[model samples]
Target: MGVFGALNAAVSGLSAQAFALENISGNIANAATVGYKRLDTSFSDLVGGGKGAQPGQIAGTVSANSRATNGLQGDLQQSQVDTYMGINGGGYFVVQGKAGEVDGRTIFSGNDLYTRRGDFEVDKEGRLVNGAGYYLMGQPIDPVTKNVSGSVPQIITIDNSVIPAVTTDRIRYEGNLPTTPQTSNQLGGGDELLDATLTKASTGAAPDAAAAGQTVGVDAINAADEVAFLNTSIAGEAITVYNSSGTPVNVQMRWAKTFEDNGTQPDTWSLYYLSDSAATGANPKWTKVSDAQFDSSAGNGGQMLVPANDAMTITGLAVDGEVVGDMTLDFGTGALTQFSDSNGSAKISKLTQNGYPSGDLAGISISEAGRLVASYSNGRTRELHEISLVSFSGEAWLERVDGGAFEVTPESGEPIAGAQGRIVGKRLESSNTDIADEFSKLIVTQQAYSANTRIVSSGDQMLQEAINMIR
Candidate 1:
């Protein structure tokens, strides 16, 4: 019985060593696989007649079990692909498997999986698919509000359709206006000289200009008036704003010093935009958009005093019949200043508009915030989806699946949102398997397997000796 037990133990030992060898070989084989987690072998001793009344018994057999290294992280490699992503700390990307296609749409398996593999790219159907054919899941974002929509993640599908045009609704302006502008009027001679009396209609107070029948047109449409107005006003920053029909219109601006502080009246200036380039008669050419009052007092200095809110609405601003709708011109607090300039021109530090023409999808990229950002051919970018990352309480207990993905097991608790790991854009995680470590295990497994065979041979010799004695 002892010999038989010894033989059984030897056979189990061989089986255990073979199991370890298989795991070692697998690890070595996947050393180059992206996001591959190494598999380790664990051994357990099985005892046969140990606790019986007959007495103590030695260990009878060995059992092998697989251990997971899913908690371990691999080195990150820089990738030229913009969508290639890598996790830095502790988390996996939530992905879904495609079961089939129905009605020109992909049918999902409904079972969520987790993986560190992020070699994803936009497929022909505009869906983000990884190299393993898994679909990346994320929360959709509202393009207008720029806010993520829901907590639950859905399969991410990019909208490759052309984005419609956005009319200019806001223009952020920041600049320093010169106290004494070197307008063409100030620098030109004779007929080119500008007449200050032909400026915008203004009351004693700067804010009263609009209320005082601002109807008095300050547009210089005639030849003499046009030359005079151009000479009197200094050029301000100009930007191209989009209209409703996706038409690009160049909005040319100018600043003219309307009123200098005469004790009672404060220093005031009028803002104008070229309304019509081909106005032949009294039709308006340059139209006054707003008035800016400056506090030129010694105590207050030269800050914007009027339009106290620092913003003005340009109602129905149009250029050459292209209506740009209404846009708010915001000059943030302290954004506008009146200072002495050698060039006597407005120094625009920031001038941007919140509008874009119709655009087609150009490219897509992953952001540091774990959001999928899409770029457009119209020089516009929009956040499409917020990438979802999930973590588990027992990462090592996850069930291994094909393509380096892991399925949830009973031991691996339900997936939790907001993982500790962050998404690294344009990078990939290499396999955690170490060739050297696998080679060392291989050598040990081979030796152990050979020793088990020797034990079997010894057991055979003992049985043969017993049989010869019987003979």
Candidate 2:
């Protein structure tokens, strides 16, 4: 019975060694697999049941258990693809498997799976899928609301549809309006100088020609008056604004120093825009838009006073048979300033408009916040969806699935929703398996397996001796 027990123990040793070897081989084989977690074999001794188990009399059967190093973080490798994403810390990307096609739509199996693999590519249907054929799930962002919709994550689909044109609604202008402007004589005199100093009067009336200092109303300035005072009083600024049909129209604007206070009152300038038929008709040639009043004591020395009601609106705009709605021009507090400078040129530091022409989907990229941003041919970017990351309390206990994915098990707690780790775009996570460590384990497994075989042979010899004695 002792010899038989010894033979059984040796057999158990060989089986345990074989199990360890299997895990070692698997680890070495998947050393280059992306986001692969290494498997390790744990050995435990099985003692025979007895009242007082002696050292040599006890059965020593060994059992091997497989454990996963799922908690280990992999090395991040830079990828050229813009959609390639990697997790830097502890977390996994929530993914779902495709069940089948239903009514020409790919249906998900509803089984939630977690993985670190992020090698995703857009399929023919514009759905983002990983190498393992799992679809990436995320929360869709509402374009109008600019908020992520829904608490539950759904399969993320890229919208390749063409974006329609949007009419210009608002124009933000920021720059320095020159106090003094260099102008040219539009009259017959090719090189004649005109007085540049602006004079003011008590009431809105025509300036006295003979009076040394006089005030002239901006509305009273006609085409001939504009030409006469072009060099001295007014400066023009023009920009192209888009209409509803995406047609660009040149909007010419003129600023005239209507009222100037020597030291007491605030200086004021009247704004005007050139009419469409101004070149052929209209004596004044331009229509007044608003008045920009500068109070020296208002803000940081002096600043333009924006109407308390709202920004100034330009209405009744028509360009090339296309009618455009009113646009608001807002000069933020302290944005427009009056300072003494040699150049009277109005410099536009920043000018932007919230309008774009019709465009096609150009490309897609992953943002730092894990949102998928789509770029259009019209030079616009829109956030389509926000990727959600899930974390588990028992990550190591997750069941290993195909393609480096893991399934939820009883030991793995429920996934906590939301972002769990910092997202890195245009990168991929490499396998956690270390080749050098695997090779070392491989050597030990090989030696251990050989030593177990010798044990079996030694047990066979001992059994043979017992059998020979019986003979």
Candidate 3:
């Protein structure tokens, strides 16, 4: 072998060794880098330069022996961008492209692309655009109503312009009015005022004319009796009502309407009571009663319920409404005319027409099926939007274009759209980098480089010996 030519062979071996070491150093430096893949360096040796080819010609010229890792597997590793979904068991979220060059026209029909990364968010446009601005494609919207009738591949938020719902537009009430017509108070001026100081009779004491010691006409007595110098005032007619159980459940009836006689019974409302003063809850339960509805007897000055001849129609003696129809109350067996006694004056407790207003926006929650719920401020919640999520069979085929978005390839197959997955708020996925594994690969590379250096040294010694023998 030629003297300088032999040295060239050693140079090739040392050069390969250097390249391997450099590759390993790079791996060590990027060990902490997310989704980084370690690389293995390959070397080639010239095999033909041993002696001359013919007798006197070189028996070996530099033929090449190549050995290396093509880095295809490394490329596969690098594809893993580290962001991992919570579950390795299955599936991942697919995001769509944003407004880009080709997508600037927005003609792609909101196609889906795959990813292992689950870090996502919604943008101002109400699209479920992740932090990368990639949209979570939802159901196809009905451009007009925005309701998803058919399958949707995306999840777009349709702002439900708040249309006020009915809170409390109506209510029913019933109660007893403690009205004592015999009391001293009068509508204008009354005889009861004058009888306050009079020493009257036991049964009929006329308040206006105490000397006429008997109660006359329909007026009540402000009975004043001072027997043997004893003085006491007795009240006039007073009225009250109670349930069948005799336990007084104070009824507060809102005025449904008032009426006048024009042969057409005048029906008009004067007041309304929204709820019972005692009842407090989201949906309070009320005692149901049809037979023993409240009304007053003809002679008694109290609230009572009497049955009617016809079974269906019962005279509703609403305590608050002005018009008291020729109604009846039924205690199952019999019926009686309701509140037919005393003056036409039936005490009415004010009724309220619903006291609540429109609801306000409260909180928002999601379901696994991608149902959006908007809670109202009035303690009422409603189902708002049904969000959709899309997936693909071959995620590796997904090409990340920009904005954390991906474009689907034919290799990715068709999009599998669904809406059963719900998002977890206030959380994120992290990169999938493995630092320890990368460092370990770097050490192996370093050892390989050292062994290659010794190989070069031994080859140099052999060439030197051959050259010395020729000298």
Candidate 4:
């Protein structure tokens, strides 16, 4: 029984070493795999049940079990693909296996899976799938609301459909209005004064007689009058805005300094926009939209002025006989200013309009905030979805699934739904397996297996000696 027990012990040792080798081989094999977690083998002794067992007696067998190093993080690898993503700290990407279709819609198996793998590519059906054939899941975002719509996450599908045109609704302008402008009469000759609204002096070389006589009131200035005045003003800017049909409409705007009331009020300037037809009309023209007043002493005592009300709604916009909807123009406080400068020209610091024409899908990208933004050919971007992450209390206890993914187990605890790590786009997580470490373990396992075989050979020799004594 003693010799037999020694033989059993050697056999168990051999089995334990073989199990360790298996883990080492697997780690070496998946060393280059993305998001691959290395497995570690642990050995325990199975003690004999005999009550008479002595302390020095070999009455125990070795047993081996594998535990995954799933908690270990892998190195981040940079990739050129825009959809590729990586997690910086902790957590896994929530995913699900594709399970056929229902009602002509792609359905996923009820089992929810998580993984560190992010090598996702858009398939023919416009669904993002990784190499392990798992579908990515995310929360849909409403473009209008700019918020995530649902509580539960669903499989993300790319929408490649063309986006319809959107008419201009709001325009924001930020810049400095010139305090002084070059007089129109200073340009060419007095003949040009015939087309202008200003009343010229008897002498052709003299400046505007009416402007010098009295101050122009905001109520007295009409669209046609402003257009005639801006034709020769030196302080103006032009920008191309889009219409409902995505057609480019040139909007020319100008500013003209008006007479200050009692010389105590703030400096005022009339704002104008050129009509669509007048843009290329025989003479360039404009229409007054509003008057901008600047008080340098207003708002934090800064050089900029805060208008009493800065929003102006422009209506009755016609482009080629097509009437566009009204657009609100916002000149944020401090956005528009009257500052002294040598150039005496209005400098547009910022000008943006919230409108885009119909556009084809150009590309897609993932942001650091886990948002999937789609870019359009018309130079517009829209957020489509927000990628979510799942974490576990016992991450190592997660059941290993095919494709380097894991499923929740009783030991792994419930999946925590929220963002757990910093998301990095255009990157991937490399496998945690180290080839050098795996090879070193392989050598140790080989030596231990060989030593166990020697022990078995010695045990057999002892058994033969005992049998010979009986003979």
- The prediction achieving the highest lDDT against the true structure is 1
lDDT of 2 by residue, 189-208 (tens): 43222333222221235543
**Candidate 4 C-alpha lDDT tens digits along 52-78:** 648654567899999889889999999
Global local distance difference test of model 2 = 0.74
lDDT rank order: 1, 4, 2, 3
Q: On lDDT, who's better, 3 or 4?
A: 4
Best by TM-score: 1
Candidate 1 — worst ten consecutive residues by lDDT sum? Answer: 200-209
**Per-residue lDDT of 1-471 in model 1, one digit per residue for the tens?**
999998999999999999999999899889989999999999999878758665676667999999999989999999999989999999999999999998988899999999999999988888888889899999999987989998999999999889999888999999999888887656754222235456333212232333332222254434336776777778887999999988998999888776666676667787888888887655567777877888888988789987999998888889889988888999999899887788989999999998889999999999989999999999988899999999999998999889999999899999989999999999999999989888988999999999999999999999999999989
Pairs with steric clashes in candidate 4: none
| Candidate 3 lDDT tens digits, 378-407 | 555555555545556764555544433456
What CA root-mean-square deviation does each model show from the true structure? 4.2, 4.8, 17.2, 5.0
lDDT per prediction? 0.85, 0.74, 0.38, 0.76
On lDDT, the stronger of 1 and 3 is 1
How badly does each model clash, as a count of residue pairs?
Answer: 1, 1, 54, 0
Candidate 1 stretches greater than 4 Å from native: 52-55, 184-217, 280-284
Distance from true position, residue 180, model 1, in Å? 1.8
